[model samples]
Target: MAPTAFLLVFSEPGPNVPEDEYNDWYDNEHIPLRVNTPAFLNWTRWKAVDGEKPTYGASYDLESYEATKKAPYTTLAETRSDREKGILANIQLLDRRHYELIEPHPIPLRHSTTRRNLPHTSSLSPEEDFNKWYHEEHIPLLAKAPGWVRSRRFILKDCGQMGVEAQKDQKPPKYMAVHEWASMDSFKSPEYKAALATPWTEKVFANVVAKERRVMTFVRKWARL
Candidate 1:
């Protein structure tokens, strides 16, 4: 179960915080603490150019659902330092979701196959049509394009049982689609564009909300458990 599931967090710093300081806190403190915890595998952060408000994002992979829910990641009231609180107060949380890897299942993801993270929420009621469209049509066709390594769809989990939920009352991101790429330019290819513009896709977008695409790159690396 090594690195079987992941937690996705999207955020934006408050108007008062400087970009440099926010990044410093993550690179210097936040990431290290999480990485040191048991069952954590890798962590990444990103900036979303075409995404929702407060366009920063991060994800952490864990050994299993249990490891994913373990205390090191779950309980938080007992674990905040002033530095942590200072950072929290200066940021706005956009969305948080937990997804168990559904694409490259039972197999470890190739390191760095994930270059850009495109996360979106579907507005289609019952949440099934949207997922069916993604898993059955959109992703299946899109994954064939050049540079596309793996595409994963994660559904929101009962995080109330996990350590600490970032936002207690807000509605969680119902669905998340993560497409790993070999290079940033792959997204601009004609095949990729064609894959996105279909009659079916139009119907899908009509029912989508907070629909966004983000530009993400490797920020740092850490030791794995």
Candidate 2:
């Protein structure tokens, strides 16, 4: 079967770097390097409205996580011009990871005003049990939240560090869920709160060894299916 994956990145400008210059390089130079690749289906950018730092996030929908380790994708960075390196040197990457789709949602990919990103790792429960809760119980409840568009889940396949002052050999959680929304209203809604209040949710989440919750608003989209 054809593989499906995501290249997710969170970042911020380095100290003394102006936001305009950082964004200019990302929009005009950095992102262009990956846009034309056939394996890359689409790319979207976002800014944090709430939650974790590094503030900026981007998602690259790809044919497979393995595509990132090959040919043009690898060559893009290896062959970066001095100017590209210069700009990269002034950026700070908070997290960079590639993940394969585990649970695909029905809603066609489209623009959304808000999103909630949950990246986590599990330790206590058996993998099957943890996933069973998410697949059979958790998502259905979350789906009932007002303004919810869709929710997709993924499993990490590869990860690496980037940018100046980047963390040394950093690693993120193994699983992630991307939840789309029409507005921020879903987060504080009764249904959303109730979803988290379930005893099953507590049981499963107790096994979540590490996690990050980031709420972001759409900034722009570069390419699409």
Candidate 3:
């Protein structure tokens, strides 16, 4: 199936830059420019109410995989202005991740899709076998909820780590899973809770080293479909 990809950026302010200006550059300048692109269909910004390290996050839904690699998108980093360049220097941490939709072929999701970023450092079972169980066993069960629209899994693509500083003691998550729901209210249903209570879910949850989750709604969406 053709996938709906997301370009997600997680960032925090540098020691010297003003918080308000940093926000303006992202909200008013950077985000607006990218959303205007033909490939970028929708945008949603979120604040980290639960996690540490990344204080802010934004996700842009792509029309296609080719959109991310094509002109304008590819040239964006190289074409940064002097003001954007200065802002880049002052940003302390920037982590970028790409995710592509993996489920509900034929029927497209219509509302907020819950984004779950999970990285497993170790597991009781072998790494290869662990993923096998997730796709065949875990994810299928979780999507059984009434509001569960669809789900997708993503692998990290190595690119543009320009200003990022990797920690010697830790590494980024190897996989990210995006689950779509008809609405936020769908998450509270009894069916959703039951799906998560399965034994396979318990086993997988035990081995996760670090995970980050964020809820987001589209501010603006542009598309042909």
Candidate 4:
């Protein structure tokens, strides 16, 4: 299979960590170890433009949602070098979530250099209406916006604790919508606003229990060799 699931990692270097060293470790050691696995397809990283604290986002394509719990992937932590462990200790992890694709676009997404990440949870019981509204009305209108490339929706399958010691049992929102853009300008365009301003959009959003909006800009991408 060509990666039907992904792992979303949110983190940032701690105040005491040097930016140069942190980036070097991430670019050289941290990402490479995971991408080297056969089940880990590709890795793409982004930085938040919304001025949020845990300012980094990384998405790792996986063979399946179960891939993270299996051999090589699960064993990587035990194989980490002392330096890698030291660097990771000083990093502040925000959230680590695993999601399986639920909305498959007619046009496949080749690459997304710029995008908006909307992770949310619904308050509606059964969530049938919420899912219906998103698939039927919401995405169609957003597709009308200029510079639209593709959209993807995923449902959370699991959550990882990482450095989140306080909320050991806490979980993130269950649904994530990743909207690809040709450029950031598309987000502020009139069509985009029109799509979001619709009555249906307002109605569905009213039932959203939790949500986080992140405007992401590309940092780098790597794939298995």
Per-candidate clashes, comma-separated: 3, 0, 1, 0
Estimate every model's Cα lDDT from 0 to 1: 0.65, 0.75, 0.62, 0.74
* Residue 67 CA displacement from its true place in model 3, Å: 3.9
Please identify model 1 stretches exceeding 4 Å from their true place: 75-77, 103-129, 158-168, 206-215
Q: Report the Cα RMSD per candidate.
A: 4.4, 3.1, 4.8, 2.7
Better model by TM-score, 3 or 4? 4
Give the Å error, residue 20, model 1. 2.5
Which residue pairs does candidate 1 place in steric collision? 74-163, 74-164, 75-163
Model 4, span 195-216: residue lDDT tens: 8898877887777787767776
**Where does model 3 exceed 4 Å of error?**
1-3, 100-137, 144-150, 159-171, 180-190, 206-225
TM-score each candidate: 0.75, 0.87, 0.70, 0.88
TM-score-best of 2 and 4 = 4
Candidate 1 weakest lDDT stretch, 10 residues: 158-167
What is the C-alpha lDDT profile of model 1 across 1-225, one tens digit per residue? 456677777666666567788888878788878877776788877676564455677778877766655687775536877977776765554355666755553223445534554444423333677766776777767666777766766666644222123456665545567777767677788878887898878887876664445566545556653
Model 2 deviation from native, Cα RMSD in Å: 3.1
Which digits, one per residue and each the tens of the lDDT, describe model 2 over residues 1-225?
344898888887767567888888778877777788777888778888776577898888888877878887778878887876876766666468888998675444545545443323223345788888877877788788777777788888877777776877777777788877777767789999998899988887777777767777788778632
